[model samples]
Target chain A: MKHRTFFWFFLPTGLAMFLFIALPIVSVVTQSVFAPHEAVLKTVENCTPLVGCTTETTIDQEATREIREAQPLGRFVGLDIYLDRGHLAIAELGEAWDTAETWGDFWDRLFNLPLYRALAFTLTFTFIVTPMLIVVGLMIALAVNSLHRHLKGLMIFFSLLPMIVTPLIGSLILFWMVDSRGIIGSALVGLAGDPNFSLKASTGLTWVMLIVYGIWHSAPFAFVVFYAGLQTLPKDQIEAAQIDGATRWQQIKYVVVPHLMPLVTFVALIQLMDNFRVFEPVVGFNASAHATSLSWIIFNDLGGETRQLSAASATSVLTIIGVAILLSPVLVRTWRDFKGK
Target chain B: MASKAQRRPLGLSILIYGFVGLWFILAAFPFFWTLWGSFKVELDFFSIANWTNAITGERTKATYDSAFTGAAYHGAWVQEEFWRNVINTFMVCFFVVLTSLTIGTLGGYALSRSGYRYTFWLLITALIFRAMPPITLVAGYLLPFFEWNVWGILPTTIIVLVAINQPFTLWMLHSFFQNIPKELDESAKVDGCTQFQAFRHVIVPVMWPGVITTGLFSFLLAYNDFAVTAMLLSESNRTMVPAIAAFLGTTYTEGNVMFAVAAVVSATAPLFILVMFFQRQIVSGLTAGAVKG
Candidate 1:
């Protein structure tokens, strides 16, 4: 294809991405370094008859409005927002480090910061969910592969339901089921023999609930991909392994898994990216009091009466950085593959 | 393939069946349970007195004189005017899929045909964009959209979603186009057809399988999205997912949790139909990227 034709063909999609995806990234970075304008204050002196002369400082609303109108991007604070307590919290980190008596104490203080707390949960969720889902998915694929032909289709159709449903709605369904008065919650109460044993009341149980939801939601995606990979498996390799007197487990370990290794990597890469953005489940589970993710933090900031754009932008920038880091391995491998080709 | 040596033992077969059955229940029970519960009143659905009330709808029978009721659905769809949000969701999904596929096919075709290093970089850029959570972009959009008075509207949200949908769409279609032996279009060009003509006449004729697969995914992305729609749309123009979320906030306080339950079930019904029809396309589309890699 000629450069001109290629240009024309690619122009619409490219322009859309540039304006929405590329430009917003730049906008987010810029907004992160800037803070919304502070209220303009003025002092007024009131002299009462033989009583007192008082000077009161009040917000000059008119001046503040004019300044904000003039510069809607707000004033540039140059990383002040990034370093503030709501974000990186450099000063708080230093205080925690200096005043802490032990490593556990120091760790507790670090987790108290909003950004670090969110980072901890996001990373924990990502790392935990990705591997567990892959295992569960592989198990389901193998089990389904061994089923009769008529049952395979039915199993797959049912399997896709959890993944195909909207993330928030799926989580909500699980959330309601696990409510204190709901079936699962009442069953747990019976098991524990404690009427007041609520899953939502404890941080540990809430985290477990979210992680279980994550696996339940995403495992089907893995199963579908692996099931497809299983369809293309070579018969000769498995037969050869069988002829060598290999057991079922050994045949799978040596022949099946090696063949599906690339697919495993592919599933891992996709799931990593998907899991890192774990926001909706947090919202649906209403687990923000016990657990928060980076995406959830940004959502919380952007919401409500405040609409704290600067804080949200800072967190957005940080989240992007986290994604870039998480993605570096895949990006490097892709670059290598392209160069080799 | 199921020869004597490959046959599973009775014990193993039983184990596999047990595991798969358990999984089947785990994967599907919640939706059916929620669907069943959505028809009952709040007390029976979340019964503190007796758990069996959820199944039998004891309180529901006492109040509505029926084991099942459409009262919740009526409350959600009529009293809350959730139909407006449902209409908005379909409108957004329709435009987002249409625009995404239209532009994506062209760009994807261009990338597949052009033998240049820049094509590689463009895809990589798209991969990066795809990885960034859409909420991160919301912060950037709020200031500008509010300033321009374009925030909280369906059209703006549609365009944003289409843009977000581009990267994955391009990658999917790009790979799909590559599989369509270049000879088809090249032969057309040899017969005096222009490049555009070749694409329009030859390539387009055979591209429906790929295009339909890609379109299914685009529709899913636009339909399943909560972040962009929830933030970008106004109260009057809210989509079903966000509307349900909003329902939780109001209905909980009003002791009308059944409204939210019905709304959730209603919102999920379309997705259930979608999966029922397009299961094959969805599975193939999912494996398309992984298999190629």
Candidate 2:
């Protein structure tokens, strides 16, 4: 296609992305630097016939409103917002380091910061779920590959349910079943021989439930990709290995896994990005008390009567940075592929 | 020679089948259990007293003179007025898909056909945009939308969603367009046709499969989104996901958890039908990236 033709063809989508996607990123970065304006203060002195003179400092609400209205993005605070207790918490980090007597205590104090706490959970969820899903998906794909042809369609039809459902609804379904009064929770109580036992009451159990939810929701994507990879496995290679006295396990270890390596990497990259933004499950499971992610923190900030836009913007910048870091490997690979082509 | 001997050992086959059976139950049993529980009264569905009450609808029978009850669904659909939100969701989904696909197709096709290095950079840019969480973009939009007084309406949300949907739509359709041999359009150009004429007469006819696949994905992205719709929409114009979330927030403290449960099931019912009808397209769309990459 000619340059003019290409330009016209690409103009509409390009303009939409520039206006919405590119511009918002710039806006978020710009907003993060500016904190909301402070209230204007004034001092007033009053002398009354019956009382001594008194002076007081009060907020000039009218002046403050005018100032804020004039500059709605608030005053530029540079990196002040980023270093506050709600975010990087630089001062809190220093205080914790100064007070701690040992490494474990220092680590505990570090995780106490809200930002660090959220980062810990987000990274833990991402790393744990990605690899576990790959292994579980491979096992499922291998087993299903060996099944009778008729069962394949039925298995796939059922397998897509958890993945295709809305993330909130999927998590809600699991949440209800595991509530203290629900069947699974009740069964657990019976098994433990204690009626007071509840899954909701513990931090560790809730994390486990959330991780299980993550694995349940995402494993099907891996399974489908790996299953497709399994179809093109070389029959002659497997037969040759078998003729050379290789057992089934050995053949699979040598042949099947290597063939699926690219698909494995594909699943890993996609899952890492997906799991980093884990937010809906937190809402659906009501696990925010026990678990919080960066996305969840941003959502919490934007919500309620306060609508803390600056705070949310700071966290948004940090999240975009985190995603960019996770995305670098894929970007590098794409660049290399493009150059090679 | 080794066909018979190559068969798995009987014990091994049994273990594989056992594992598969277990996974099948784990993958699918949650929906079935929830669908069953949604019908019974709250006490019987939860059943803190007797576990069998959940399966037998023991409390539902005592109150309503029937083992099954439609009270939860009635409460969710009628009393809660969740139908309004459902209509809003479809409205948002319809416009987002239409606008995203309309532009995404043109841009993706252009990028694929153009033999220039700039196409590479554009795709990389789209990838970066696609990777950023939509919630992050919400923070950027809040101030402007608040200032302009356009934050809480359906059209603003629709346009925002279309933009959010653009990156992935472009990426998916770009790959799909690449799969269509370039010769189809080139041949038309060799005749007495301009570039647009070739795209209209020659390329469009053969492009439905790829476009449909990409469109299916765009619909899923718009439908499954929570962050954009939840934050951008007002209380009166909320989509189904946000509405269900609202039900949870309000109903949980009110001792009406079943309202949220019913709403969740109602929200999932459309997705169930979608999967039933378009399973192939979804699967193909999913593996399209993995297989090509």
Question: Evaluated with DockQ, which candidate comes out highest?
Answer: 1
lDDT of 1 by residue, B1-293 (tens): 47888988999999999999999999999999999999999999999999999999999999999999999999999999999999998999999989999999999999999998899999999999999999999999998999899999999999999999999999999999999999999999999998899999999999999999999889888888998888999999999999898998888899999999999999899989988998899999999999977
Q: Pick by TM-score: which candidate is best? A: 1
Q: In candidate 2, what are the lDDT values of residues A4-103, reduced to their tens digit?
A: 9999999999999998989998999999999999999999998888888899999999999999999988999999999999999999999988999999
Each candidate's fnat: 0.84, 0.86
TM-score of chain A of each: 0.98, 0.97
What ranges in model 1 sit over 4 Å off? none
**lDDT for residue A136 in candidate 1, whole number 0-100:** 96
For candidate 1, write residues A152-263 as lDDT tens digits. 9999999999999999999999999999999899999999999999999998999999999999999999999999999999989999999999999999899999999999
